[model samples]
Target chain A: MRYWLTSAFIFLLVTAFSQEPPSTGFLRHLMDREYYKEVVYLLEQTDYDDASLARKDSINYIKGWSLYSMKALQRSAGVLKSVSRESPYYLPAHFFAAYNHAHLGQYGTAGQTLDSLRLENSNMASLRAFENAGIALLQRDYKAFEDRFNQADTSYYPIKKASDKMLDFARDLESHRKKSPVVAGAMSAIVPGAGKIYAGQTGEGISAFLTAGGLGFVTWENYHKNGWKDVKTLLFGAVFAAFYGGNIYGTVVSVEITENEFQKAYDNKILFNLHIPLRNVFN
Target chain B: MFLTKVSGQPEALHRADSLFKEGAFFEASIAYERTVYLQPESKVVHRARYKKAVAYRHLHRYEDALRELDRLPLFSIADTLKSRILYETAFNHLLLDKPEEALWNFRRLEKTREEPLHSSMIPLKILILNHNRKWEEAKGTLLSLVDSMPLRPHKKQSWKDSIKSLYDEDSLPKNYSEEKAKNLSRFIPGAGHIYTGYPWEGAASFLLNGAAIGFGIHQLWYKYYFTAYITGFGIFYKSYFGGMKRAAHLAEIARHNEMKKFNDKCSAMMMRILK
Candidate 1:
């Protein structure tokens, strides 16, 4: 009797405050407030097994978008790719899913995602071409980039600037002079910091020059002043020799670092350009 | 009437709270958010939001808790609710290692009428103030709070004395300026190290630099200009710059040690009161 009464009282308390929330607008409202975590959580908890195809698409789109915003790219891609072609969310889903794949370095899959989409929308076709060009650029394949870029209709407003930027990358990469380690090392041996300068590190080259020059002078002075037998002369000579050798080694290492840094910076730009149009067109 | 017409204990607020109690904080956070949407009343919404932030805190997601807490309308909230929000915000900020934000929230909360809550937070506030190196402010706060306590006059005075002693100038950390140490070492190699309490190292540095300079002068006097310029000046150049950097580094370590010792003492003194 006591347990039942207590249960009844609890039921009454629950019913006293009970009100049905409008399901359709509630998720949208949570999304508007940027409560992405909540949006995902709510969707996960609610039973949507019997939801209509269109309804399912909308739910999946929302889930993917929330995951994307939270930077869960792999999960976002998986969820987004599930949105059916019949749904209004198809274009954005496919585009972002491709972007996520590309981001995760699944270049082949990303290209295939774009390639398989046979959109009649002229703008989407251009977007597809632009995205393909970006992928080629990331792979550093200039020829593929040029062919795909020419197919892209640059007149599409959302992708026009990005298209131009992609072309610039093509031009820049074609003329880019990657420094060779052997040439840099040879130059450093001849002129202490010349190799670093050729590696595009002017400041470092000048600093190296001074250090090496100073050490060379020290070695010369020690030999001239103390007949090359005094402890001071020997010590200075040894120190000077080490600095000279280290400078040449450092020049080679610096050239490699500069080249790698340049490649990374350009790749980041290519990725960023690819992302802009997706946001502009989808949003 | 509308709420009562349907079956809702906050549309699962009780369930959310139960989840929180069961240590299912992540799930509780989601459930709290569900309640926020399902429940129409602004008060219920606020309650749910606060509970969600608390759940996030339990999950050690202080940044998320702070984000959720920021959605609450501070000016429009009830005073008690406002006090709790401020208290929770301070706690989250402290947990996130943001002493400044935590201190600001604690000070704002002090303006409320919740005397017991404010009193309870005194030690923590002092701890934060001490962490930030605002020693005088912490000292004043502790002394004032002691004065306001209804303890016997003698006991109160003793407490005040104890608090004052904790903030004594003699007990404070030695403040070493890295810039000053660097500057001193630039003019005289190892002077900064001496100032930072490494006398033997400082002497060694001084000898090395002095010998280099002397060798350069001796070579110059002998009319071996190239030898003096290269061997003597080259050694001096490296030693001089290297000594300056080492001096600044030593000063940083010295200052860190002193501050740690001072903060440790402060923490120990406040431990009993805080507990």
Candidate 2:
């Protein structure tokens, strides 16, 4: 009779324990193993009120990091922003939040966040300077970037090297030729297709020259043969005038487009350089 | 052990079914997979596998869905259930763009059973045939299916008329012929482009060629034969002939694109019928 009672008790115990909800520790384990999908599922099913303060911070951090890895930048930023200042993970969470902001093209917000980090050591100061330089570069303030970069201590050789490379890149960008639409229009007015050639569009320049010159020649020949009274002469004259005016206008537009294209390409290169230093220093 | 297995199976199935009903296909598939692993030898296992396959399909993981269906033992399931599995297998193949494989499975089902689900297979078969450019067979199959539907004579005649119109559109004659296009431009430098519906290009070609020929003649009259032949006439003639050939090729391509448009429209209509 005692054996039967003990068996019943053990069975009930086993069943009760088996039905218990999954613990936060197991969720952390899944996160540590990089089972992100399972972490997401388990985290959604968990009640945060049951966890301790430290566990709650850990959960939020892991969830934010996982979402960042998944490229859900806005959600990651929101969750990381919730990490309280007293938590041990707060600094790293803030750092990632800055990066997420930068990735979303909010360079000003990213710079301010990095600036707000309390610099307790030389390493922190250097990191702040590096991120500040990145923001300056993205903002196209080369002078400000150089000032921040030169002030950063050179104890970290990688940071020193990255800063030096970026300074040279900024100098190269400053040296690149920039076109003016007004100048291009004036040049084309003097000679057909000259503005396009000045904007580095040689093929288009040649085509414009041929088109304008061909129409002008046809108009002149028609006027010479048929006199001013002929409708054919007037028609050719009007067509030639329209094409000549269009060539000058088109050259101005082409110059603006060329400048815009250069700016886009240069800006992308600067953004790439900015992100590279962050990745190198942080990783 | 047997009792434990029997008791555990329902819990897993119920959880999976709840997840499935909640539109959590990925999690439901995972849960159903776990249930299948727990009771691999039970008859309920087949149902679990089928639902898992369905979950994968909902997730747009057709290859995984087909993999699940492939593991199903057809001999162990009832005929009705087996036919449903076969239909799903064919549907997955169709989604994967493997129309030949889909058609083969669909035909297998047609030979074995005539269920309500099997009725949907006819439109899918027509789609496959049309996609493969087997228009005549698609038409025949469509007409037969329409005839089998319980509709009045006028409604059936309307369906026949729509199918005929689709067939005629698909088989419409090419508006431009390459041979005629090339010959027309050979006689008149820009005529071919105009024939092919490019009047601006025709004008450009005519003006450029006329200027070159006139310049060449004037140069020859002044006894500068080298400039006349080499610089003026030679390049002009080459461009003129090349433009003609290009216009002809473009016309042929345009005709092909029109036929493709018709085919795409028919395919969309057939898909609508399936839905």
The number of the candidate with the highest DockQ is 1
Off by over 4 Å in 1: A1-30, A33-57, A84-87, A118-123, A227-234, B1-41, B44-75, B88-107, B114-118, B129-170, B175-275
lDDT (10s digit) by residue, model 1, range B87-156: 8898899878788999899878878645555566677777678767898998997787776667788877
What overall lDDT goes with each candidate model?
0.81, 0.72
The window of 10 residues in a row where model 2 chain B has the poorest summed lDDT is B1-10
Misplaced by over 4 Å in model 2 are: A1-53, A66-75, A86-88, A154-161, A227-230, A281-283, B1-16, B19-123, B135-275
Give the least accurate 10-residue stretch of model 1 chain B, judged by summed lDDT.
B1-10
| Positional deviation of residue B105's Cα in model 1 after best superposition, in angstroms | 4.7
Indicate which candidate wins on TM-score: 1
For residue A202, give model 1's deviation from the true position in Å. Answer: 1.3
Name every residue pair that clashes in candidate 1: A18-B7, A18-B8
lDDT of 1 by residue, A112-203 (tens): 98898859687888999999999988888888988999899998999999888888987888799989999999999999999999999999
Interface C-alpha root-mean-square deviation, candidates in order = 8.1, 11.6
For model 2 the local lDDT of residue B7 reads: 45
> A14 in model 2: Cα distance from truth in Å?
22
Which candidate leads in lDDT?
1
